[model samples]
Target: MSINIINRSGHPLPAYQTAHAAGMDVYAHLPAEPVTLGPLQRALIPTGLFLEIPEGYEAQVRPRSGLAYRHGIGIVNSPGTIDADYRGELKVLLVNLSDTDFVVQDGERIAQLVVARHERVAWQAAEELSETQRGAGGYGSTGTK
Candidate 1:
């Protein structure tokens, strides 16, 4: 499936690094200067790109595991969604969870974009519902061991 995009970020288009990669690495569109995120601070970093996703599909913005594990940087929303009908710039909300400051350079791989097909649910109100063996069990209802 192909999607339309308008890029003004002066960086290469988002692409999968290897075969069978589900997400495409997205880059920071900052200029020569880098943005610094202080401890516990968050910033909205623009990608300078707009997308046009097809119907019945949505684009998801996710945090990079390497960045989160190495630099303690992650997206404010783990899986930010871009609606299929929405036409707007793609930006990332990054937060620095570590005590030290983290610098985000231009063209740095900040997040990833994954386009997926989704289905809308139709609500059918009813008085009774089917039951299961573990029905209505809250968190940790099943033993850890």
Candidate 2:
């Protein structure tokens, strides 16, 4: 499926791709220097682009595994939900967990976007409902190991 991308700035932005695949597209800023994240620091990094997501679908923002494994830098909200009705700029919230500083280049592939389906449930008031064997048992109640 093709998603519409809008580069609000005059410069060009890169595209998205899977890690196993080479030549994945990435968007970058023109004159701004790369972003550096200090230990225990958090920042909202802008994507320099906007999206026009189609209705009945949502875009999820996720982190790049390489960045997380190598630099201890990852998106605070893994698989962040971007509602279909949201028409604002696409930004990423990154957090640095390592002791050293992490740098984010202008064109770096900081995150990935996945489009998926969502459901909206209707609210109802009921005194009782059907029962199951695991009813009301949560957390580790099922089993261990």
Query: Each model's C-alpha lDDT?
Result: 0.94, 0.74
lDDT of 1 by residue, 1-145 (tens): 8899999999989999999999999999998588999999999999998999999999999999999999999999879999988888999999999999999999999999999999999999999889997898879987755
- Give each prediction's root-mean-square deviation over alpha carbons: 1.2, 3.3
- Across 3-109, the per-residue lDDT of candidate 2 in tens digits comes to 68888655455444556642233343424777789999988887777877788788888777788899997788887878877878888888999999988776677
Question: Which candidate achieves the best lDDT against the true structure?
Answer: 1
Task: Show where candidate 2 strays beyond 4 Å.
Answer: 8-30
What would you estimate as the lDDT of candidate 2? 0.74
TM-score for each of the candidates:
0.95, 0.81
